[model samples]
Target: MDRGGLVVELGPGAGGTTRAILDALPPDGRLLSIELNPHLHRLVEAIPDRRLIAHRGSACELPAVLAAHGFAAADAVVSGIPFSTMPRAVGARTAAAIAECLAADGRFVAYQASARVAELCSPHLGTPRVDTELLNFPPMRVFRWERTGG
Candidate 1:
């Protein structure tokens, strides 16, 4: 990420991806991670990066989360959420909040095991393009949804 830019992360179940994001972030950049499960939130908090903020909250609470953290929008967002396994309505609601939080040129990157997530996010995040990460256990599909408009 660009130096000093803001990036939001959702469902950081484990610290693996969180560590990767932190490593990639420029010293001045920040990553606000929202984890629905308190247990997982604490695990993410154990990551020692100065740029990371681990919050215990649902993705639906994104607006308030950002506001409380002094962020108006994000340069980029990442999610490890399993939208396909979640309630469609809840996924849509979370997607809407993410749409509102993204900067004009920002992208929402999701690691999905199914196509349902991309379909669910399309209305709020625009169509997503896919890439495969073959090295993963089940081979992950990475979907990227860019901000819908300029």
Candidate 2:
């Protein structure tokens, strides 16, 4: 895949996936990571990467935050948020926000504990394709969504 567009990451707990994206993207590509936890933000920030910018905020504010950064859209939005831990209302709102931030052809990739796929999909803004990954701790399912229509 081309690595020339902006990438937004939601709920990157400690920058593990963030590191992977940074390594994959070109120098001209930009990565904006939103982390809700202050402690996690500090840990993510310690990693030296001019391409990575960690925002201390919630995923629900993704669209506005990306706009404030002069980005109207992103090529992809990857998430590692703990959807199972969120209340239904918040989860629904966050899901909406995620859909809003993506460009028409943009992709949203999220990783959730295996047991939470049904719960997570219940509030998703668009249809998602889920793939289970038993290699992860506690095992996980990767959900991918692509906005339909341009």
In terms of lDDT, the best-performing candidate is 1
Q: Write the per-residue lDDT of candidate 2 for residues 88-140, one digit (tens) a residue.
A: 67777787787677788888888887435345544654567889888877778
- TM-score list, all predictions: 0.95, 0.89
Clashes of each: 0, 0
| Candidate 2 Cα outliers beyond 4 Å, as residue runs | 114-125, 148-150
